[model samples]
Target: MVKVSIFGSTGTIGKNVAFTLAREDTVDEIVMVARPESLDKVKGETYDMYDALAARDIDCRLTPTCNFHDIEGSAIVLISAGIPREKGMKRLDLAVPNAKIVAYYSRQVAKYAPDAIILVATNPVDVMTTIALEASKFDKMKVFGVGNHLDSLRLKNYFSRHININSSEVHTRVVGEHGDHMVPLLSSTTIGGIPLKYFVEYVDLDITGLVERLKNAGNTIISKKGATEYGPAYAISNLISTIITDTHKVLTVSCYLDGEIENVEDVSLGVPAVISKRGLEMIVPIHMNDIEKRNFMKAAETVREATYEVKEHMNM
Candidate 1:
């Protein structure tokens, strides 16, 4: 029986995560944590867990509470509590506020659910992930951020259309920061054991424009729908499922910096990682072209700058 808790249960990503996990029989119980005043707000939602359980034929109960102490004994905790970025806004704009949120909850998790696998989905994800790691002082392997999974998904979707192949047949990754600095590994992309370049040639298409399009995919969605949640929510769910089931899946997650990528130091950014009950078990380093390497460095620098600012503000 897997016990789980969602810290921002009423928010867009949080709500979708809860709804998705609630449908799984593998999840024994799910606790939705919200601010004291927001409890009523959640209860009023259309697909709120309370309502879902009430209308269900099963005898299981879905717990919702504002108290952190009530969130104990969970195998995993998804932290989706943070501000969403606007279309034209930089993720750094959310640093101060989201850092505070991450710090506060980090202490709470340290106190109440120290062993839980903490999955962070907050904006300014890289910095907030660093804050959580420092504040919680938990094993670095046990805390990670939902970062480039959505970006990788977008890359695969675009590649599928370009190659006229099914998305499931494409294997690719978008590494580095989740924001504008994402590095798409075109060299590593493959369609049924064939290189992406070969597939592109077969289709007689230009793939250069598609790279920029994939990089700015989030802004496009935000411009159209105001905020992006569904894709990210699904990505987070996939990560959580791996941990809960001890699946040890390889995924792109924002993990701590330890000089694994050379010259990149002290920041969280998306890289291919093995996820299991240990949270982020291992960082998988992939080869990069000179341009992709430069972009990855830029992404690392952005996160490092943000981390410095967060430390200055919090005086940590």
Candidate 2:
């Protein structure tokens, strides 16, 4: 039976993950982990979530991490426990506090679920995911972050909205940092194999404004809802399902770069990668235009700067 562990079970993303996984037959057990202070609170919500699922004829073993002992034997460890970005907050600003939380849990996860796949879902994800990778001392292939996957989804959704088509008809990938530096590859993006420029002309759309909105989609949602959850929640669920089913699908996720792209050394950035039961199956290179190349490089620097900003707070 496949057992999955969620480290921030009480948070919005974690709760959403729990509810989504509760209906997945591939998941035989769902372990909800929380800090000791939040243990009882999460346990209460766990039962509430699981009971509701049960009423719908969905069932899975629900466990709490009051002791954190049962994190062992989990097939996947999703680290969503960290400082969330608030209104008017830049993702990089949450780096320090979230890094501390990520570091401590990364150590514990390394000690407990050493063989499990580690996926980070925190803000400034490029920085925090790298922190988790280094702190856990795990092979880079064994860990990653749900970064541009969410960004790409948002990009596709926004483009699809403008064209008045189902998002599935759009084939797009957003790369680079998961923040303001993200690059939505227009050269490589297509709609039903149609170039983005074709759609802009056909729809008489403003390309520049559309790209800006795509970049700030997160802040846009958080401004009204106080949090952005639905898109990320389902994005992560898709990743989790891909892993559970061992589907070797390429997703725009955050992984280490050791010459994958020149000049960026020892950092995590969002790029095309194949994910399967083995975690990072492979990294795929995207053909970039001159402008995209410059932007991708700038994104690398932005990610490194974000990490440096949080470096003083981390032991590494």
Candidate 3:
């Protein structure tokens, strides 16, 4: 049995994550925390979750609170508290405020649940993840952001649609910034263990437009819907379940690097990493072509700059 704590349980992603984890038999308890102002809403969401679980006859204990102390003994503390991006806003546009929010909660996590693995889902997640790592003073491996995992899922979907193949057979990755400069690792993508190039020689994959569409996918959803909910929810829950089960799945996520990849350090950028019960087990070194390398470095710089800006904004 595992106890998980969600810092922003009232938001769309948080709510979705709560419901998804509730269904997981490994997650025996969830502590849903909201700000004092949203205490009532969180309590209601908890009751609502209880009702849903009862309907399905799943016996997961759920608690809602505005108190940070209640998060004690949690094995996972997911931080999703931040301003949701507006239609026209870039993810970086949320850096300053979200950094502050993440920092505050990181400290609380450190105090109440220092052993917990921190999964940051706030907007501008890469930057917020770095802030969380610093503020919580946790080992870098224990703190990670959920962005590239979601991006990779989107990449897989796009590949499946264009190639008309089963999505399960399409293995692709998107690294670097989870934002505009994310690098779609076409160099490493495979379909049923076959290199993408073999198929590219025959099929018109429209690689250029594919990356553009992948980059804009999140914004496109945000433009149509108020905010993205289910995709991230499912992706994050999969990650959580993997951790609880010690599956050690290799997933692309934003994790800190210190010579794990060339020339990138002290920043959280999206890359493929092995996820285990201990949190980030290792950052897998995948091959990248010249163009993919250049774009990935650029994305690293973009997130690094934004991370610095957030630090300065928060006076950290």
Candidate 4:
């Protein structure tokens, strides 16, 4: 039985995660934590959410608290507490403020849930993951962001819809930051070991155009709904399941490069990794051609700049 704790469990992504995990048999406990200032509000909100879930017969031991000790001994710790990006606001625009928030909570997480796998869901996630990892001083493998998984899923969805095929049949990946600089590997995408091009001639598939769309998919959803929830919420829950089950699945996730890719190190960016309870057990760098390598490097540079910006913000 795995015990998980969500630091921002009253928000859209947080509530969805709480509700989803409440029904999972493997999840023995769920602790929904909020910032100290919003303790009462978050507790009330969690109670209401639990009531609603109970109405649907989704039962699990869900506890909401503002105490840091409640997060201790957690098998997984999810940091999703941050502001959403508004229209016209870039993901990098959120770097400074969200980094401070992530770093503060990361220290608390370090002190309490020292051994828990830290999963960051905050925006400009690559930057936030870097801040969290540095602040917590945890093993790099145990800290990651959920951005790449969602981005890759969006890429797979695009291919699935275009060819009228099940999404699971397509194997593709999106790397780098979770924003405009996201790199989609289209040149080598395959479906069940067959090249993607074999089926995409159905229409003049614009690879670059599709990548641009994949980069903006979150913004599009934010425009439609006040926030983008389902994809990210499901992405976090899926990762939790992956870690708890020790599936060691090779999924794209945002983590510090270390020697995973050329010219990108000490900065957090999305890359394919084998994930399990031991955290990112392996780096599965997707084979990138010359052009794809250039794109991925460009994306890595963008994240590197954001990390520098975060450092500047901290000094200020």
Model 2 over residues 1-316: C-alpha lDDT tens digits? Answer: 8989998888999978877887766798889888889989888987787778877787688888766679898899999988888999998888898898988888988898889999999877899888999899999998899989998988888888887889889999999999889998998788987887776677767779988998888898999999988888889989999999998999999988887865567779999999999999888867889999999999988888778768755657
lDDT of each: 0.83, 0.87, 0.91, 0.84
Query: 271-299, model 4: which lDDT tens digit per residue?
Result: 88999889999888577888878978888
TM-score: model 4 vs. ground truth = 0.94
TM-score of each: 0.94, 0.96, 0.97, 0.94
Find the candidate with the highest lDDT and give its number.
3
Which 10-residue span in candidate 4 carries the lowest summed lDDT?
Answer: 199-208
Clashes of each: 0, 0, 0, 0
What are the RMSD figures for all models against the true structure? Answer: 1.9, 1.3, 1.1, 1.8
Q: What is the alpha-carbon lDDT of model 4 when measured against the actual structure?
A: 0.84
Q: For residues 192-276, what per-residue lDDT tens digits would candidate 3 score against the true structure?
A: 8899889788788788898899888888999998889999999999999988999999998889889798668988998989999
